[model samples]
Target chain A: MRSDFVRREVATGLRRNVTMTVAMVLTTAISLALLGTGMLAVRTIDSTESLYADRLEIQVALTQDVSAADQDCSQPICSGLKKTLENSPLVESVTFESQQEAYTRFQQLFAGQSIADVARPQSLPATLRVKLADQQTGADAVRQAMNGQVGVRTIIDQRDVVGKLFDFLGGVRNVTFALALVQAVAALLLISNTVQVSAYTRRVEVGVMRLVGATRWYTQLPFLIEAVLTGVVGAVLAGVGLVVAKFAFIDDLLAGIAQNGVIPPITIYDVLETSIWLLPIGAAIAGVTGYVTLRLYVKV
Target chain B: MVAMATVATHEGSSLPLTLGDGRGGIRERSPRRAEGAGRTRVAGAAPGTVPTVIRLERVTKMYKTSTRPALDRVSVSVDKGEFVFLIGPSGSGKSTFLRLLLREDVPTRGRITVADLDVAKLPRRRVPRLRQRIGVVFQDFRLLPNRTVGGNVAFALEVIGKPQATIARVVPEVLELVGLEGKADRMPHELSGGEQQRVAIARAFVNRPLVLLADEPTGNLDPDTSQDIMLLLERINRTGTTVVMATHDHSIVDSMRRRVVELDLGQVVRDESRGVYGVGR
Candidate 1:
């Protein structure tokens, strides 16, 4: 027979067996819910990381104070360092600041402290500030560029903060996947047991088909189809539940946190997209799991 | 009475057969080997009558578990349009023989040729096409509980990819043939013991198979019901379908006056023309 004919027969069989059908749908829902949550968690980590990374800017702070002998040596030293850094290809820009200018900026930061008393303005060390091409350019490269250059003591990278944030998100994604794995296994076993019982109850019918020259695949197609259909139902239910939970709870929580600017916000569309894709994937998992589990007991 | 004719025969060798008169009397035929020539002739006909439909050459089947074989070196030839009964105790391999003919199980040794095809060597993919030519019935009446009586009957046609229009048309005709036309819409549970067996018969005959193989078909039915089912099978046999039924019912076998192939401990002990079920009636 054609595959269409087999598919139709399988559908008819699933429709007739109500208990098995419901079990399949429920199993599918649970598994997909776990998987969907995992996927959404990964997306959230990815989206938020990109947001933080995009906003990242390199800051080059200029140091102050220099001896007259050192100022003459450091000025050209600072100037030569700028050209070297700018020509090094990693540097996006080279800007210079005088010790008096640095002193004036420090006075603006702490209004009560006078520039002369904080440190003699004339005695302040003048230096060059270099901004890199991107936040990803590390401090090591800048350090290497300024190596052996007098008065160029240290270099700091701004993107290190973003890297730490990504490290934290990576850990969250791992937890999400681990949880999804457990839930998927549990759901697979439960649905398989459900289908096995269905097959056991209809053993007479199955045995009859076997005696009558029906192949193993012919007998199994119906149960697999039923499992998939049930999975679809479960996925739909889980999706609805996830949507309601996100809107009713998560959305308000994220909105509240948005005001403090502490944690990044999660959107409804993101959750919706995550939930929508889970249906087919959930159905496939349920169908495959049930079929495999039932296979050990039911054979031709 | 037409006499038996034997081919490739030796001295004192003879082949015995009973030809039906259509008026219900049995005609005995005996052939004797001719000298010098390797041909034997019946009293009424010349030599070389090639009437056999199923021929087995020392076929044997041994399952994995048991030490002894199921069927041991069985060699027999059945003619077209013959109604034969296969009788044996449990484990005597009557079912095995039938399965061999249906190509459901292969013989461990020797060869079996069914419907001019070397069934023992038939490829797996072509087995379904081979099965299409043979109708099979079982003791349990293996009907799908979810399907109606008519649906069960139509299933054979459906599996072979017959058109819906053809299934719809043929289902009713077969149901009518089995005298279960009025019970078409009824499910298996709704039918009585006899009616259910009739449904199974209708399903077997529905495909218009060349041979009908029924294994303990009426083993669960009452005497009267079993007789009715036997009559249905006999009626179908008259329409040119080679019928081979396996049963322990001696009364039914004796009353039918058909060829009987008897098995005991995996060996054929008797092959009688119009044979009776010898014991355990």
Candidate 2:
């Protein structure tokens, strides 16, 4: 068939089935939007993990001897512990925190808390802040070396905090992905149903075309093109929706963290790239669904 | 006029004409005869040796729902450029015969050939190519409602991948041929019953098919209109394109006095040269 005539037929079909076409487009758009949001979650988690990994620090709190003897930082036991951490190859740097310095830092960090006002300088535990040469590796060697140290009460690795954050973000990504899957199925069904209705309306023309020696593909191509156009339009709308959600909702919610550079922003470039990729994908999926439905259900 | 009419190749009714999935029913036909069958004319052949374009041997179509076959042991051969009328009652095998020629319904038992090709052995992918060589007009004029008369006629050429220059040149000539020269811009409903049938005939004839099958071209038109349609078909046949028309109009059949092949209860009851509708009834 002539490309010019086929295009006119597609336009006629869309106009005739306006409501079903709209439903197909909207469902496709919403599903693609959910897919884009899922991609954002993955991007955020990835950037966050890489950004904070290099700044990781392990903190060892000084022992408190309420039952027998207290930790004396200026004595031999404390001095020996500091010397060992300072000379170790795994340790990048070690800073000794006196009770006074620890309490002052606590007050600065938690100024509005009642606990900071009641805490005494001598009662506060002195912590040894040890930065690792490798941000995420070799924590086990450091722990083994300080296993039986008398001055240490607890060893806290910054990697654990990073792990917990990633776990939470991964859970969020899973939920987003699940919702995206459901929406995708709905979009596929809507596309198939709309194409079916469109084909039903054109059955008479199709029968005539077949009798006139039109090949099966020629009869089926117009419906497939209509579906592909609907999907592409839907993908464009979804991309726009994603940009709006990012600027109007996500960026605003994370404004403080983004501004302070605590976590990298989900930039407009990321949204644009993902959205650009969706155009072809949406068209392909819609085309396949329409083609399969025609093959299986519609004779023409 | 029929140039030649051959005898039935099968003498007995017991041998089924089934060669399904390339399994059975292979026959040895002369290559020269095959080539002759493909042409509208063969120069060297005398009257008795003319090419037989269609040969059906021991053909039968049995539907699971119906206890009887639609076409039972019906063997007939149509020579090139013959205008034959298939006359029968509603339950007879006229439609089934037309469908078999088009390869729309495969016969459960038979070897059918058209234009040097075994239709039963023809692959599914080749059905379109076969159909392009044949034209069919139905009881109801199945013109596309949305397309104009020219568009409906041009559609046949367009689907076959005819170049734009060819389509533009051929479409107008076909419209003139069908006596719709000024009605090219009109839609199907804008034309009367006779004009609509004429447009359909134009679409069918535009491709210049080797054979044209009219199931009931004038089944819905009045007497005067039916006469014009039959005249148009006669003109088409004069151009050396063979036509097989099936109809229930006894008066038209009696008046035309063409070669009539009558079917009764899925069997060929009589075959007459220059016969009437019910001369054999």
Candidate 3:
């Protein structure tokens, strides 16, 4: 009930076992940092998926006859396919690219590549770029509508390539979580061990206190507070570590992909948001571990 | 069964001899009265006479590891402000008797009443409150090595949430009473064995408890040092605190000539007023 006494006891307990206290703090910090990184990776993956989802579209390539014959999609065969696609309920909008325009875009897509030299205007086929209202079922509906029609060649779903990128990011998240779990287990052992050692070192004083009318809870409270204090300090260290990692590690590692807008950047805000959660999570783990250790191994 | 007959004869014949205060009638009814709710009331005492502060009725303790009970059907009482000695061999349950009074261990059977609180019936959460009314000292002194003498004494009040003002005011008073006023700033290791015991006594007595239970207070000290400590305890006993001490030291008990209860094999063999150690054995 006395704050000063509790504070004094906590300070003494932590100071008496300085090495164990430091070990506990460092372990908790590393584990919580890994957990924060895993959470941020998940956020990044979600944002990247939404960013590409807005621009996702299906490409419909026409036959070579259509490419050679149609100049501006003014011919009946070319214009008819564009009109049908635009009229479908699944299609949000349709734009046609002639062979010459497709060739220009292809050169821009691979400007510095050796393959650009082999492509001519007649080599690239005329195509219709179709934006869908819904990504999940619209691509199938568009492919079914144009199946085996005259002047139609193939339908390309862009999501197939983008899905691979997401899979890689998901893998990163899973790996981070798995590593975090392992580190968390290490941190748990350290916390419990520290509590036990601290309790053991102070057994004489605690026994005296109990004999002199101090409650069991009163004697054990200092140990609990010491654990929680270490946990909170570790959380603060983990938060700082996350912010530094964003700039020092994550940004540099993700530079190329983030520049191309293939994945969202790991911002300071994202790291901070994830870091805020580590405080409570760290405290809960330390508190529960302290309580259980005392109950099971140490009487006081 | 032989011990039970010995106990009956001892109670019937020796009970009257020990009633030195002329309260023999009330003393005779105590075992029956302890069984009921009237244990706290001194039925026929003079207007200002002290009431019974501790009572044990047919108390028995059986530790599972051993067939012999640690204590067997032990019955005794001590009045307020009285100094009583529990003398026995090492394994004759002297320490167990003090431990049961402190509620550190429970008797397997029978009732113990200390400061009007039934030991068995007290709730676990309320045990601390019961202990607050009693002070305990051990042979080892059990002082916190890291804390100063003042800090160790103040610790007793601090853990119970006493304010800083009260701790500052009362710690020095207790230290002075125990004759360690100037040694408050010294650590436990800095003091001699006798002085260290004084610090432990200061800590225990700082709370002004109703009863003081000492388990071999002089077990670790020299003869001269033990005598000094006994004098200090006697001084404290004069302040109206009941003192129950268990000891293996015969000289101190024989010299003090206080009421002595002798135990042998977990049974009370003799309880005498102004008794000496090993008087008839």
Compose the digit string of candidate 1's lDDT tens values, residues A101-126.
Answer: 66677666567656446665665555
Better model by DockQ, 1 or 2?
A: 2
lDDT against true structure, model 3: 0.84
Q: Per-residue alpha-carbon lDDT of model 2 for B58-112, expressed as tens digits?
A: 8999878899999988787777777778988998999999989888889999889
lDDT measured at residue A185 in model 1 versus the true structure, 0 to 100: 75
Which segments of model 2 are wrong by more than 4 Å? A65-105, A111-124, A128-149, B1-49, B60-68, B107-109, B279-281
Per-candidate DockQ values are 0.25, 0.49, 0.69
Candidate RMSDs in Å, in order, are 7.8, 6.1, 5.2
Docking class of 2: medium
**Sort order, DockQ high to low:** 3, 2, 1
**Cα shift from native, residue B198, model 1 (Å):** 1.2
Best of the candidates, TM-score: 3
- Per-residue lDDT for A1-300 in model 2, tens only? 578768877998999999999999999998888888888879889899878866877877777651113334557777778788889888888877777677789899789999888987767777777888865455876787777688787788887877887787788788888988898999999999988999999888787767776887678888999999998999999999999998899899889877877678889998998888779989999999999999899977
TM-score of 1: 0.76
The residue ranges of model 1 lying beyond 4 angstroms of the native Cα positions read: A1-23, A48-80, A94-131, A134-139, A146-154, A210-218, A249-269, A290-297, B1-57, B100-113, B116-126, B145-147, B158-161, B187-190, B279-281
Report the number of the highest-lDDT candidate: 3
Quality of candidate 3 docking, DockQ: 0.69
Clashing pairs in 2: B17-B110
